[model samples]
Target: MTRFYWRKYRSLGVVTTLAILYLIVRAKNYEHKAFVFLANVHPSEPWEFVADFSNMKYLNPTIIDFNLLDESGDYVHWKYSLEYSEKLSHWPHSYNTAVAHFNIKASPKKDSYFIHSTHKTCLLFGLYCLNSVSEFKFSHGNSSKGASCEEHIQYQCPTVLSSFCRREVVYQRKAIMNNLFKKFDGRKF
Candidate 1:
């Protein structure tokens, strides 16, 4: 009876191992692009929110701590709060903070303001293999609150080894839009 149980358990273990191996082997790099619209936000609002790393909390709620590591003209390097390692028990142990770099541009185009951002790589958070770019355009409009605007955001991620974190991107996008459209859209920053 003990031998029979042992065999059953061994087979189960082997199957689980095979499944993990299959996932690892089948993991292919991919690229994803998506767009979203934010209503009631001014044309210049999103650009101002992202111009400084100090304002990251306006977009990503999970970030508890943010520190600027380096900065230069059109480039920024920072370590933002992350919990990927804690949540992924199988992931290799490393630093808890995720380091990210971005190249940003803010442009004025007559009736709209465009903010272009490209993410190079993020280390120690399973994002080192991915490259991302985002463009935000805010169009000015008329509203009862004096001046209102719509935000159009385009997001693209390339060379993703796994789709596990794709949903996180979507969530972040929605969070940013939600924050941007909140009651306080005219506050001075």
Candidate 2:
């Protein structure tokens, strides 16, 4: 019985190793672009909220929000929080807080989407997150240290700045959408 079990276990390990190789090959473009937005998303959404792209080195961005337990074992829904690094007082450091802080528990009234919403208009800014199934928001442009959330840009030409947290507004479509739904359409689209 022991010999039989070992044979099966060895085969399983080999299969898992092959799968990891495939993933690494597919991640070639990950470093090319960085994003930040909602920290998590609803199970219904395709891509869970991705707050940063730096974390990509250790994380595999997923659109599927599932029940997971962190080191504490508490049921915390963790979405793609753009895994990146920064200088802490001039020291290099990785951060996913900007991505983790974004919580979109409202909007579309559903837990879905992976990209960020620049505004209430559902603009494709960067990433999106949903905790319950209500609120939702997006982040765009690059981010830098000492940069304010609304003042930093999450993306720069599809490349997320890896300097500091510079949460800048990349999309104003939300304002336009609000006005359109509010019987106001004088603003540009």
Candidate 3:
């Protein structure tokens, strides 16, 4: 009877281990989002704005500080500090600051320019982390009246926090675009 009980417990442990591994693998899968928008300006105008790393703080308000670490040819390495807060049920409100690193490359095509960027941020000593790849395509508008931009982003994070991360990504991207338009329309760009 003791041997039988031991075998049963071993089987249960194996199953539990497998379940945890599956959850970790599933949670690490990347999620993707794509969007397009039109702006009343030339493609080069928006391309210039995005290619300049110094303009990032103006484009994203959450970015409290930005620094360009290095630049070589078409590639740029930069880092920034992002400030955010979270309020969870039955928990104290928390304000946090995260530092993220970025590697970006700009490629110019015949009629469009592409900005490809990879972002990495880890929290709690790498216990929780987020990584993302973003591609931005800038070209002439379909109606020939202005410019059009296509943005594709893929990100991975823990399963429990995926929804919150996804919402924040979408919100930030939209805010950046709106700010971009406002800048150009106000003739501040």
Best-performing candidate as measured by lDDT: 3
**Each prediction's Cα RMSD?**
8.4, 18.6, 5.6
Candidate 3 lDDT tens digits, 7-34: 9999999999999876754556565554
Superposition error at 104 for model 1 (Å): 3.8
Q: State every prediction's TM-score relative to the real structure.
A: 0.51, 0.18, 0.67
| Count of clashes in candidate 1 | 0
- Top-down lDDT ranking: 3, 1, 2
Over the stretch 16-47, how does candidate 1's per-residue lDDT look in tens digits? 99988666544333444433344455545555
lDDT by residue (11-43, candidate 2, tens digit) is 999999998765533311111222222222223
By TM-score: ranked, best first: 3, 1, 2
The model with the greatest TM-score is: 3
Considering only N, C-alpha and C atoms within 3 Å, which residue pairs clash in candidate 1?
A: none
The per-residue C-alpha lDDT of model 1 at residue 41 equals 53
Model 2 weakest 10-residue run by lDDT: 144-153
Clashes of each: 0, 53, 0
